[model samples]
Target: MSDAPIRVLVCDDQALVRTGYVTIFSAQPDMEVVGEAGNGHEAVSAAQRLHPDVVVMDIRMPLLDGIEATRKLAGPEVVEPPKVLVVTTFNVDAYVYDAFRAGASGFLLKDSPPAELVAGIRTVARGEALLAPTVTRHLIGRFAERLRPADTARPGRADLVRALTARELEVLELIAEGLSNAEIAAALFISPETVKTYVSRILTKLGLRDRVQAVVLAYRVGLVTAAD
Candidate 1:
């Protein structure tokens, strides 16, 4: 990581909640709270003006919603976008799934421990996607039904087979299974560095931004399913 402290912007609809996030983020040595927004419109404006490295975004807000704000900040059309870490109150929120589709880099419940929140910011700042294990398992699966329709037209298993090597397909399947680099490495009897290389290759070949997209694609194409 860079020696510079990670710059952050916190956005929420409530004053007390925003302040709490500000206080928690400000206390971290490696983090700097650059700005705060009480709603999504302000979040987009603040993110554009301040250019925070990571945006701690809330889901529901007045004027605009966090999903749209995240899209404005980190959507695929953006030339260069900050990492967006979406924090919400509900674990089963469909908005969280939409946030990911809008290009959020991470997702966390508002009730997540301070340490997890801090770690989430750090992870996204490093250009890594952060989804808690439970979120990966339950949240994604819970919304699988809703996602299937939009995903039905996406590239299917045959496309994936043609586009990737057998080993790369294995790596993608393990990724969709929510395994970390170390876990995948152990499972395949390969080094973590090798797994990292495979992941990078998979992302490049598939034109995916991160593991979240990879997981989504895996499910969409029937390479893996929530049931599995």
Candidate 2:
């Protein structure tokens, strides 16, 4: 990682909320607010010009919405996409799934505590998706139900393991259950750094943005069942 502080762009239509997010990032010793955007159009432009390490994006905005902005900035076709952390009033339905599919590294609540906000930014900056335990347990389950697919449509469960080593697959299963790097390390009798490598490999092999997408893919591919 670079020695420079993590650069962030705070994007939200509401002035008060935007300023509040800037204040949170400003207070962090290792974070800097590079710029701010009041709408998604501004967000995409600032992201391209400033090239921030992370974009703290709000879902609703005046001109372009956060989902579309995220797509433009971090879509799969982009050569080097910046990390995006979606901040909103709530993680409701398609909003959460669509944001992740759009390439957001994580989803966070607007009212999240300052400490959590800081930790979240750091986590995403390190290339990990920030899936709050509460957010994952609740939202992911509902999302799975709403998106139930036919057996023929679902990718074969066995095919999911074709690219991953046994250890990597184990790490992925734990990740799908919402275990953090440290937690997964302890459970598997390995170091956190090793766990990070596995997570990175998983994302690369699956062409996913972050852990949120990994979890969704794990479920869809049948590596994990709803009972898990």
Candidate 3:
């Protein structure tokens, strides 16, 4: 548990969705609901004013959508940005790729259990990206398939790949394949705790803030192929 509470802003066009998140997040001792917005325009404004640690955003909204809002708030254009978590109903949402491209730290289904939602927020708040295996493959592999090989090949990215130990590299490939920690552990014949440790070490060695960044790095550096 963290010493300080993580302040959060909830954004969704549906009032019920916003209210539910407020109810769930407020129950956590280490989190607080600082504000709520009904649209992307309002979300952006509220984020700027409240400066919450995390923003729970919905993709479809009036005035602006979560994708654009995420871009404005956390995109490459922003020097300093708060973490944004895309909470939506779609399992394989088309906008997910755009959300990540726009700098979202994590993506979750709206129906996700409260525990996972809380974990996602905390993970992102701590400067770690949450790439649930399914979501990662759906976004990265699918997107890469549409790109040219030359575009995927990035110079110097191989240096980061070279930095990983054999074990860590194995973990990265499994992550690219969208295997859960437990699955990766089982496949690698190691304990789940060990897999977790390797994942953390991989992120640290690669200077990646989170799993989302790791997935991006894997794709950008051509560590994982779309066919894989």
Which candidate ranks first by lDDT, i.e. highest? 1
Total backbone clashes of candidate 2, pairs 3 or more residues apart or in separate chains: 0
Q: Model 3, range 1-228, lDDT digits (tens) per residue?
A: 358899999999999888999999999999999999999999999999999999999999999999999989987557678999998887665677778777888888888899999999987886656776666665687775442222124466569788889999999888777676778899999998898899899878775555666676687667886656
Candidate 2 TM-score versus the reference: 0.87
Give me the overall lDDT of model 1. 0.83
Per-model CA lDDT versus the true structure = 0.83, 0.82, 0.81
- Order the candidate numbers by TM-score, best to worst: 2, 1, 3
Better of 1 and 2 by TM-score: 2
lDDT, model 2, position 91: 54
lDDT of 2 by residue, 1-228 (tens): 578999999999999988888887898889999999999999999999999999999999989999999999987677788899999996586788888777788888888888888898998898777886556655666565443322213455447556789898999888878788999999999999999989988877766666766777666667776665
- Rank candidates, lDDT, best first: 1, 2, 3
Clashing pairs in 2: none
Whose TM-score is higher: candidate 1's or candidate 3's?
1
lDDT of 3: 0.81
Which 10-residue window of candidate 2 scores lowest in summed lDDT? 145-154
TM-score of each: 0.85, 0.87, 0.77
